[model samples]
Each structure stands twice: as structure tokens, then as C-alpha cells.
Target: MTLVIGLVVHRSHHRLFQEAARTLTGVRLEWVDYEAEDEIRARTAGLLDRQRLDGLLLGPVPYARCRDLLPPDLPVTVTRSAGLDLALAWCRALARGWPATPVSIDTFDQETVDEVAAALDLDRERIACLPFDPDQPVAEIVEFHRRFLDRFGGRYVISVRTGVVAAFAGAVPVLSGLAGLGTIRAELHELALRSQSKRASERRFAAGVFLIAKPERSANLDRARIGLMNMLLNTPEYADGWIEDRGRRGVIVFAHQALFEAVTHNWVSLPVLAQAQDTLGVRVVAGFGVGPSARTCVALAERAANRAEQDDSPGAYLIEESGVMIGPMGPAGHPLHFTYRAHGAGIERLAERVGLSPATLSRLAAVERGLDGQAVSPSDLAGSLGITDPSGRRLIRKLSESGLVIPEGSAQVNRKGRPSRLYRLGIGAALAAGATAPAGPGDAAGGDGGRDGDGPVDGGRRDG
Candidate 1:
């Protein structure tokens, strides 16, 4: 699928951004031009409403300007000049016989101004640094630069902000503080990767194969197939070709893995199927499977369907490629004992006790179940979560901090090199320590394992 990204730019740099976007492949870039920062705020609701956009790029303004305004789930990248770009621009100006003294520079913070001065080996006093708020008006920045030029007698200006550059009006030789093509391309590449990662995390793959027991003379197999297909088509996550008939006695349906997950959380799609079963006076048995590949899903689903057909009761059954069985879902699609169902509430409570959101808790539970109680490395967790390894590491760190998990051992995931550390579920310990405040005495222990008030609180070893 072509990844579509939104590029929000100021009126001034529309051409530049458009040219850059034209060079990208495997991605569609949509440009949304706004006259001012407020315009962006005004249009945020509309921008977010565009469901087709996979990510967003904010131009001119720093991400700080509107980061809080955008949807938290949408990946965003802000165009800003890197330090190397600033250094190069300064070098170019100086090589062109521009005086280094009395240089007026516009930047986002004082720290950057100091870094620029240090990088250029210029006296700090000679560099008139004018700091601007990320959300401030361009006119204010222009006025600040004008005052700096007058007071410091600067003959040259370096500005990364698009708004500040527009106010130049030929008053002084202006050097662009914006990042060069190479840097911009690198940032875009990073953003694209993030967008792809998000999409991967959201993608769900599952398929189900069904077999109908020979029914009374009034029921029709062809009509049942049509009804099943129609039911699947009505759901947003499933579509055409997602369902098909295997034979007069069998049928198949493809869907996102999330469908089964939601069923445990009270989604009533299963009940609709039960109603159909009752109306048709036919016993329907289905087998569901979730896998990374279509072939694997179909194979597992078929195996499950066969198992269901052989069973005495008509229900849904899920079989893992590893041969794990979890079902016997009744006509209403209620699984008697699904792993997710068993751990879901525990995870919710754990999340609350550890100050984590339910979403994170759910993801953690998924990882734990996938590992089958085995210790998992950060990389393994990252793969399961469809996120970067670093993100997985960060999440593991948070879980450890919450006393919900403990480091266990290390294992080599690759052919060569030292093994990576592993962690196991410490839910029992977490529950035991649930009464303790998050900021327990161990907060100042400095990785020293000696701070022990009681049970699980002391179990957090630095390398346990």
C-alpha cells in the first residue's frame, strides 16, 4: 500500500517542500499550507479527520509550536536546522568575505546560540543571539532581529526560522539556518520509518474456516455463504474476498486479528453469527488462526476448522501453528477459556497499580502470552509489538520500574556477539507489591538491591 503523509507548511516555503516531496517514492505526500500558526490550530481538527494520512510533517515552526495540538497517535516530524547545517551556513558566509563580528543569529534557544558560537569559534559577545518562542509571532521575531542589527551593528544575519527569513527585505546579507538537503532527507527517512512502524503495529492478520453440519431440509449452504460474506463485508476491518465457500459443507472467512480480540471485550459480532445459525437451523463450527503470513493463517485456520467439525459441539476454535488450542466458543462466539480473556483484567489492574495506561498494559499482556511464560529480550518484545528495539527497551525499563517485571537472564538472538538481557513476567511480585507507592524507598537506592521493605519490593535486582 502507498503510504500517504501530510506536510503542513507555511505559505513561504510551499515551493521548497513541494519539490522535496516530489523526489520521494513509495509514499504520497499531501501538502497543507497555512498562513500562520493559528491557521494550523484552526485546521488541526480537519487535518486529523483525514483518515488516509499515515503521518504528518510540520514545516517552518518547531514541533514544540504545535506538538500538543496534534493527535498523539499520529507520527509527526518537525523541520528544523541541525547544528552541522548552521555551521556550514556560517562557514559559507565567512568564506564570502562576510565579517564574522556583529553577526545577528535567530535561534530557538540560548543553548543553541552558544553551541553555534562555539562551533564557529567566534567570540560569544560578538554573536547577537535573538531567541524566539516557538509559538510567537513572526513579526515579533522580525522586530527582535531589527533591534539586534541596530544595537550590535551586525552586517550579516543567520536564521533558520522561515518566518524570520521572510522579514529580511534586503536589509542584510541573510544566510539560511535551515537544514541542507542531506539533513532534510535524513529526517524524512526517519519519519517515514516511524510511519511504517505505526502501520505495521496496527495491521492485524487472522482467518477462519467454517464447516456446517448437515442441516434440516429447510437450510441452504449457498444462502449461508452469502449471509456470512455479507456479515463480514459490513464490518470495516473485513472486505470482499475475505470470505469464501470451501464446499457445500465448509466455508471460510478472513479478518483482522483484532476482531477476535475485540470479541473478548464485548464486541457482539459473534452473536450475529449465532443468530444466523439459529435462523438457518444449522450447526456451524469455525476454526480461527492468526499468523504473520496469509498461507500460515489459512493452513492453521483449516486445521482448526477440521478439529471443530470433528467435535461434538458446534462452536469456534482457534489453533496456533504451535498446536495450542483455545476455544470451543459457543454459538455466541464466547470462548470458554481464551488466554487473552484470562489475563486481560489482571493486566488492566496491573496497569492501574503501576501507573500505566490500559493500552500499554494490553500490549504487555500480548507480549507475555506470545512468549508463553518464557523470558523475553527487548528485541523479541519489539518484534512482537511491531516497534523499534529502542522503544521496546524503553517500555521494558518502565515495566521494570513499576515492579511488574524483573530481569532474568541473557540470550543470543543473532549469530555472533554478546547475548542480550532478558525479562520475565513478575505479575505475582507486582501484585504483592501493589500496595506500595510507586516512589518507594528504592527510588534512591542507585541500583543497589538492598532496599527491602517486604516481599516483591526487594525482588527487583539490577540483573535478577
Candidate 2:
């Protein structure tokens, strides 16, 4: 299938994005060009209504403008100017005979600015930076540049915001620090890969095991099972699924992962469990598993269902092939738990020490195990966790500060743009160390009061 990618670009960057998109094969680019940020909402809405996009690629400005309009499942990539772009901009300033020091830069993070300065052997203290804030008004950003220029007597302004350049009105030299062609092309390629991966994942086999939580008696068990199977067969959400009797008290449904995702609301909740409880007068617990094969999926689903049955209430749990577990997904469900199979206490203690939730640590541990000691980029981690790329980067920083990850060079997934730094998770080793070490003073206090069971752990909410 030819992937349709929606490109939400400003008029100034449209040509560059188009040029980058030319390199992509087996994909069609749908342009939603806007002159101003305010126009993004209408233009993006029009494009989405008119075309079905497999993925979306847009700048931070357009993303901030119309993030609410984007479909929750769409693969969206927000392109940002990397440190290389900033370095090139500095090179241009040098060629123009402008002093690099006493320069104000906007949009790029302070870390990038510092890195660039360090690499170029320039004074970091003199380089004023206003990092990108999606909520900051363009006028406020303009004023920030003006104030910095007036106070520091800066030689020039380097900005990623196209509007800021014209706003300057020839008052100062504003070098456009937009993402270069290389960065745009790399992002486009990444988005295309993501779209293809998403499509393939949707087609993968998934299984669900629904068990009667409290069967009345052996005499009525078969009746209850049959009724549950009937309900599943009648469910429009399960229309495409293959429903059958799994055991005396359990019913199984086999379907594509996409069907189950919709039925379970992306694994956040299980409305069918509640329906069975209300209508059948018997509480039902469900477990869903996604895997590459039918047999593996069923085995995982049965294990997940057993885990859910241990809970006091009717709820659902999901176990992916990668070993990530999420559970208790009903109306009265607690915060989602991304739990380790057996290393629960160690994860909790490590999470407390690092000032992170055990659930987040558990998910990271699962990701690490799946990698089998291979390093991963923050973007890859983000995709695995259903989070935005920036959030993944922040998580990486936190893990780095806690010494829970080791930097392992970088990998350039595409031919252009800056390569992504890779990190190997130290979680398994950290868990082993925490297990053998004597309990510290904090450990005596129960260390965040997190338990080692399949109980709830905080901080599993997906980022917007």
C-alpha cells in the first residue's frame, strides 16, 4: 500500500520540505501549507477531513497549533533543528563577519547551544538562549530577542521561528536557523518507517482470554461460558474476531491486533468486562496478548488472564510479546501497572532511589530485555512506550542522571541529519545490585510505599 503522509508546513518551509519529501518512495505527500500559525487549525482540519493519512510530519509550531486535531493513532513526527543546524548557522555568521559571541538563539535547547559552543570552542556564557516553548507566544519570543539584543549588544539573532525574522524589521540580522534539508529528509524517512511498522503491527495476531471470575456452580459453568461466547459474538467490536470456548469457564477470541486495540481503547480500558458482569450476573476478567503467532498469543493471553484473576475485581490485563504488562483496566481500575514478571521489589526500590515510578522503570526494563543488550534511541523507546519523542528524550536524561543507562555511541537511521545517541539500559544490573545490597534507611520506610505484587504503581499515564 502506498502511504499517504500529511505534511503540515509553513509557507516559508514548504519548499524545503517538498524537496526533502522528493527522496521518499512509495509515499505520497499531502501538503497543508499555512502562512500563519492561526491558519493551521483550519488547514490541517481540511487536509485530515479530505484525506486519510498514514502518518503526519510537521514542525513544532504547526504541531502546537493543531495537536488537538490530530488523530490519536496517527504517527506524528515533530521536526526540530538539531545541533548540526545550529552549528551551520554559526558558520554562516562567521562567514558574514559577525562575532559568534553576544548572539541570541531561540528555539534550540540550551543543551544544544552549549554543545555547539563547546565543539566550536566559543564562549558559552555570552551565548544567550531562549529554548523552545510551545506555549510561548510569537510576540513574547520576539520581545525576548529584542530584550537580549538590547541588553547584551548581541551581533546577530539566530532563530528557528520564521515569523521572528520578519518581525525584526531589519533592526537586527536574523539568520534563519530552520532545520536544514538533511534533517527534514531524515524525519520524513523516519515517519514513513513508523507508518509502515504501524500497519504491520495492526495485522499481527492477538488473542483474548475471558474467564468467569466467580462461577456460580459446576452445573451452570458451561451455560455461563456459552453465554459469554454469545455476547462476544454479538459484540460489534468483536465482529471480526473468532470467538470460541477456551475452557470450562473461559472463552477466547482471536483477531487482528487492531480490532482488539479498538475494543480495549488502546489497552486503557475494557468495557466488555463490565458489560458481561452487568448482563450475565457473573463477573468476567479478561486478558489480551499480542504476539507474532497464534499459539504464542494464546499462551500469553492465558497467563495474563490468570494474573487478572488474582485481582479482587473484574478487570483486564495485557501482555505484549516484548514482555510489557499493563493491567486492571476497568472503570474502578487503579493506575496502570507496567510490572516486571518477578523482579518487583527490586524495581520499586530502584525507582524510589531514582525518583521515578516503579511502573515506568518496569516498562523500561521490559524494553531493555527485548533489546537483548542492544542500545536504542530515545525515539525508538518513545514509540515502544506510546509517547512523544521529546518525552522519551527527557526520560533518557533522567535515567542517565540516575546512572541507570550507559551511552553507547550513536546510530544514523537515515543517510542525513544528526545521528541519534544510543543507550544500553542498566536496569537489569541495577535490579541485581539492589537485591543483594542491605536495606538502607529509606528502604526501612518502605521506599515510596510501593509493593512487590501485581498491585498498582504510579506514573503510567501516557503523555499528550
Backbone clash pairs in model 1 (N, Cα, C under 3 Å; residues 3+ apart or in different chains), count: 0
Tens digits of per-residue lDDT for model 2, 1-464 = 34668998889788899899877875656799888788989999988875667899998888988999998989999999999999999999999898988898999999999998999999888888999898898899999888988888997899998789879866788998899999899999999999999988887899999999866544588877876775664343453456677879998887789877777777888877766776677889999898888999999999999999899888889999999999778844222222332353576668788877655666567566545555678887776655678888988998999999999777555566876787878998888876755544343321223222222221222110
Top lDDT hit: 2
TM-score of predicted model 1?
0.49
CA lDDT scores, all candidates in order: 0.61, 0.77
lDDT of 2: 0.77
**lDDT of candidate 1 over 26-69, digit per residue (tens):** 56566677775667765655665533466788765635655776
Segments in model 2 whose C-alpha atoms lie over 4 Å from true places: 45-54, 67-74, 93-103, 117-128, 143-156, 169-173, 212-224, 247-249, 277-283, 307-313, 321-324, 331-464
Q: What is the TM-score of each candidate against the true structure?
A: 0.49, 0.61
RMSD of each: 22.5, 21.4
Clash counts for the predictions, in order: 0, 0
